[model samples]
Target: MSMHQAGIIEKKDFDVKPYYNQLSSRTTHLKDIFEIYYRYEISKEEKFVMTPGFLNFQDIKKGTVLANSNGADVVADHASRLFMPLYQNQGNDGFFAVRKIPKSFLLVSAFCRKHRIDKLLPLLPGISWKSKDKDVLRVNKRVARVFAKQLFHLMGYRSKTWNKEYLEVRNREAAARYNEYQNEAWFRAAFE
Candidate 1:
């Protein structure tokens, strides 16, 4: 069988045995050689660029191109999901339409609404909290599980919990673009 068909290199080459031997000798134990090949191939391509971390919505734009290597499993998993749709043979004939309202406006509106909801969550009935020794509020897990985490994700915020008690959230948008979105009517209505 030819080395290209055996999945050694992305493109067909005249000789694969030498390249395969070099790659195999570099690793002490058996591993996924295809991933090594992918990294090497991507490095040679001028248009492809791989980020050391996860790609957020802010990193994607109309002409933005992204590549991924096997450095981080989380990054690879996310990149696979992000690029999987491109490999599928699907048609969007009637599934989508041009939006009359700008997407940024819609996203900002959702962000404002989520922020308002978060502020009011601690005051809702069935919600109870206590201040920990370090002045951190330990919210009721029942309410947090039902609302906070999922809501934050939907509004483009990354959420994490400390000891299942304190939830921390960070916006996923680019910091440089914060001022641009903050001036929107929806952002002002909820925040200002």
Candidate 2:
């Protein structure tokens, strides 16, 4: 009474024609998949904002009263590039400033990152690699009398903390997860 004895050769003998037919009707477009991946690849910005000055938009002048911090009117000690005057009741920051980065800057940064040029930072007068990985830099403010924070930013170093002897800078690229796409079939398929 077994199926093997009933005349059926085997279930594996079935062709399942519809399955092959369906595969033939469908096509996997690499471009479509890449577009979806590209959509997610868009870079994000890091914003510095304060609660009290959350809504101020006008240009803040130097010495402008920013907020009442610790019962003291927080005044702009220097000229403001942008201003967020404190208007909110419960907030810490008085204002934030934003600027547009040029496309060339991004292009140059990518080139530097791809080539691992940041490793050379340790050769500078006051800069040294924090670890063997060379992902972080320790900057001695005294030795780097001429170097500015903007220069480090241009090379992808950000999120800085200053101690008595050195400024610790972490690479922005290290925090970004762009490497996830490196081994993606869709990413590799484009070149092939």
| Candidate 2 lDDT, 1-192, residue by residue in tens | 133323344546755566646654663321121100001111133222233443323445777765544455656565534433434443444345534456777667667766777878888788898888666899997864567776787688887888899998999766656576557554444334
Residue 153 shift from truth in candidate 2, angstroms: 1.6
Residue-wise C-alpha lDDT for candidate 1, range 55-150, written one tens digit per residue: 211223333334433442113322221221122223321111111334555576576655644445447754433433212234455656667564
TM-score per candidate, chains pooled: 0.29, 0.49
Q: Give each model's whole-structure lDDT.
A: 0.40, 0.57
For model 1, what is the alpha-carbon lDDT of residue 31?
41
Task: Locate the minimum summed-lDDT window of 10 residues in model 2.
Answer: 33-42
C-alpha lDDT of candidate 1 relative to the true structure = 0.40
**Model 2 lDDT at residue 150:** 66
List pairs with backbone clashes in candidate 2.
Answer: 50-93
Segments of candidate 2 deviating more than 4 angstroms: 1-56, 83-91, 99-107, 123-126, 140-143, 161-166, 179-192
